[model samples]
Target chain A: MMTRTFLVALIGLSMGSFGWADNPNKPDDNTTPPSAETSVSPLPTITGGLVFNSTFTPGTQSYSPVVNPIVLVPLGNRFLFESEYNVNSDLTRDHGAWNPRQLNREIEYMQLDYMVNPHLTIVVGRVFTPFGIYIERYHPEWIRDLQVAPIIFGISHQQSMGAELRGAVHLNSKVDLTYTGFYAFNSTINYFTGDRGLGGRTSLFFPEKGVEAGFSYNRRLGDNRFNLYAFDGTWNMKSIPLDLRTEVFKTGMLGNGYWVEGAYRLNKHSHNSFLRKSQVVLRGEQYFTPSAADMAMTSMSGMMMGDNFLPDQNTTRGFAGWNYWVSDAVKLSFAFGRSFALGENQNIYSLGITYRFATGGSEK
Target chain B: MKSTLAIAFLTSLLMAVPAAAGNPSKTPHSHEIDGEAAYKANCTRCHIAIHTYSARSERTMISHMRVRANLTKDEADAIFQYMAGEQKPKAAPTHTAKGAAIP
Candidate 1:
């Protein structure tokens, strides 16, 4: 409790010191030397989201509260420093009593980026592995359309400590080519560990059509020598407020899987207020193991060897969910899913709420 | 089964082209680019809320998005203009850093 209070107080003090609560209409601070040519640099800002979830399964119930915070500091016109952290706790019902688990704190990424030009940026330090669109773009609790992760998520290396080159180039009037290439070093340091690997991702984005498709390739080096390949795509319909996304991945020996999801917001087509605030989402996925022996091998190797949270046999799952936007920053969500394994079928239910917040930005 | 899945995926990709092509109305004219349209096109995939930030912070945020979202320079600039309310007149040509007119 004292640690939580201290953390809250520290955040509050930081926000106050940065003038995050200042009125945007107020005049600039008058104490500075009023040199007309001296420009006002942007202040560092904090932005992120908090989520609370309650889930029920056949014989157990669990609750998770998570806070993900991101900080961005602009160094100059062309350089910026950014970092993100995830603090979460899980409480589960065991023997009819709630058992609280230890808090899990993780550093998502900490990196410095230099925008060299319109088409290239240099990034160094710890960064999310550029494998598929999910980990980098939709992993955040507040942003994901569904509450649960895809089946293929275990194959992705969550983060890497290394250097990366990323940028976008205009291919023509309506198309753009975006790419990222990186090399990560092996590390065992606490909170900053990563397998040595090299990988790259490339995509063609049709801005006019609101569609993007990409492929990623990663080659792991060392004792766990293997190659991982992934393909992902996203499309936002121009004719309606609908989104379609899909990902397919294959990791050598361990397993292969695919998931496709669709979400539709009713706002664009509805005049009723409640309907306008509502969204419906559906997702389907399948995972296949090479064999029972491979499954046994994977389970024995543990999470670091890509056996985290996966079933011991082939599985297929389908989910349907609804989300209501209480406000732009707050949301309420519910989902029901069913999964089929070798000889068993299970039902999963989840209810959650998420609140997103930002500070040290302009007070619009 | 794998072959069927691959074929279905390819068919969906193929279907998207026509569907996209049919919606010519959403495309901005060659002479003028709409900042709000560009913003909606590029930035609304993950979330829908648009937070206001100081000019400097706004630029930094958009730059960050440019990297994360893989937005082209023109799209980023257009979004910046729209968010900042600094959009040029419809008749005016928005020039890139190279002084080339954006299509």
Candidate 2:
């Protein structure tokens, strides 16, 4: 079944590309004069590409493959349409619960973006929540040192139906304010309820001499509201033997919860040759959540509880991971850690490969 | 509908109240919560402060450590309050006047 669907999509893409390149002007444009076609503007074009990911879990001897192909259709100079479908194979038998094993299931993201101006724009539809770097771009081969994400940010927060406005207002060569405001409907599958949410965020950066610091915040309101506050600082020195970039962030979740992370790339630039991609990424983190007496009672009973009614439990964890990039589009990563009283000792490893192609419009 | 609207308005007001005073640059510190001692007693078993070095995003850092530490949201807030006190302001660097350097 999946194979037939893939073939159909592949044929549609081939035919669409052929039509786009052959005519340059599409047949659907009514504005084009039936008699004087020369004066008519060109019709939008559609371009497509593919992304395939295969992973091998050494411990379990399991193999999982995911393919996410994208089709981009230009609406005009100021607008474009994007559609991507992610299909994957099963890996549940080998791994425990929470395994990302959606076999041939297709999840999609479609977006309509209007360029309000050069520095600002509005996007609506199935949108990516721009909470952090990884959540925004968690495709195969894009992120290094991957473990779906930590519970604080990764599991609890995600993308959904929404609209967002974002832009960077430059003050000078070295200073700019980047801002985004968004609203989303609760995800039926991932969220606690089907309520709607709204959030706004802003950041400031100085990028001229390799020193950058920024602050960001997001407040999501729905049936259960979640809020985040963050501060980030990074420095890059290119004159050293190897290019180096180091960054640190302090973030808070909910009303009072917070955590900190720091990363340093020592050999970031020396990989001019085949071995140059072997930069070292070292990172560490500490986070804890205390258990409330009410939560203890609720857990003890194992019954349904409201969001604000659960007893809070305290937990903390620390982990380290490494990424070895074999090429610009391929990498191998591994991370291991032990949590305190939670008893969630686990190790994760992943290998990924990617390829990218461009056609009429800019890459999403 | 009226009640729902009232509840939403009240919740929005509550959420707004925290943001006004919680800006990191605007506010320097948080008061200590009672859960700090409970966190140290229970969470130190596996999670420690040095764990912050292992993550790139603050959300990832906290979420990853939260599971291991067996912490709840309120408990997590308490520990965060403790860490807020530990945060040190970056010291101004001592500088010697350089002849050719531009200010």
Candidate 3:
């Protein structure tokens, strides 16, 4: 607890250096040098949402509560302070007497963004790892189609601590290129451990068609040869309310997998009731577990390769679901999945509800 | 300087209480959102702000966004116009192409 307190105090001290809170309405701080571009801006706002998921498989039931919050604080014209908090809980009940409940609360990301120019923005602190489209796009429960994450999403290097340079350049009206490259140092403060690595992702986005495909690669500094790569594609049809997304990932030693998912809105601009605000989702995936020898050779390898998650065997999973919009902020989703493996096949079912809300950021 | 910092910290802490406990908005129904509001909700979360594109660029970008974000044609147009610096909604243009997705 003391450690947490100290960390909070440290954050306070850092914010004070920017003088954002002290003089929230002060004219640009020009008297002394400023860490970021100076601006007299509105109060930094808070945004995020609460998500809850429940899953049932045979005799067991699990309820997961996810509270993810994001804070956006603009320090000045050039610098912005942003932080995301993730607090999760799992309540489980089994026929057996021993049921373990787990709670994890950590800072998912906190960073300062410096807009160097139209072509680049510099970031310092912990930032989301630009591995695949999922990490940056669909990982948030509020934005995802289904309640349960893909099996392959477990090993995604979610975040890193260090500096990143990212931005986009529009070559012409028809096409634009976006890029992110970073070098992060390894550190552990509290429950969160930063992955020290060097890597970047580059993608060409078609702004007019609402489609972009890109590739990502990362190498851990600890082990030079420990590399990961991902290729992703996204398409949103302009004629119809349909979106298709696919990603292929290969982690040097953690194994490899690919998943394709699609979401379709039933009706657009129609005055119908439920059908107007409804959406259907479908997903299929294949994963190949790393060889035992490969797992043993890698640094993040775990003991017992074939125990669960099909460490050795090839596995295929398919899921289908639907989402109903109760209101703008609240929605209901139900999904069912079947895992095909060598031995006993398992079925998974999930029903989840998510609510989203935000404050401030009303400025132009 | 120290006093200013303290006040700032206290003020931020106080502001957080309401946001954490209270609802800023309900899930926004289509009618509840407008061109600017829809643009803010859809575009701001990912990038800091929308980049200014020419009318043609905006139309294409909106077409892609319409599919990706599951936006109606009107919603996409609003965003396009917003990026084109059109704050107020206007009547449909009469010269739209026969098969153009944007009205």
**How does chain B score by TM in each prediction?**
0.51, 0.35, 0.47
lDDT tens readout by residue for model 3, A1-364: 3223334543443344333222335443211222121112324555566888999887778898888887766555446677878898888888644377888787878887764432345578887777777776677676778887776676563678876655544444455455666666778776446756666676777745767888887765554346778998988666776778888988857788999998877756455777765778999998887777777776444322211233366789899999876655567899999988789478989999887655542223
In order of TM-score, best first, we have: 1, 3, 2
* Model 3 error, position A299 (Å): 4.8
In model 1, the runs with Cα more than 4 Å from the true position are A1-40, A292-308, B1-34, B86-103
Q: What value does the lDDT take at residue A175 in candidate 2?
A: 54
Give the runs in model 2 whose Cα sits over 4 Å from its true position.
A1-63, A93-101, A104-108, A137-140, A145-148, A155-157, A185-194, A233-237, A240-274, A290-325, A334-341, A353-364, B1-103
lDDT of 1 at B95: 12
Task: In candidate 3, list every pair of residues with a backbone clash.
Answer: A207-B61, A208-B60, A208-B61, A209-B64, A210-B64, A328-B27, A328-B28, A329-B27
Which digits, one per residue and each the tens of the lDDT, describe model 2 over residues A160-268?
Answer: 5766555444344345445555556655663222235444444554434444444444554554444455554444332441222222223232212333333333343
lDDT, candidate 1, A158-218, per-residue tens:
7888766676655556886677766677888988878776666778988779899999877
Candidates 2 and 3, the one with greater lDDT: 3
The predicted structure with the larger TM-score, 1 or 3, is 1
The prediction achieving the highest lDDT against the true structure is 1
Q: Which pairs clash in the backbone of model 1? A: A362-B53, A362-B54
Q: After superposition, which runs of candidate 3 have C-alpha atoms over 4 Å from their true positions?
A: A1-42, A96-98, A299-313, A361-364, B1-103
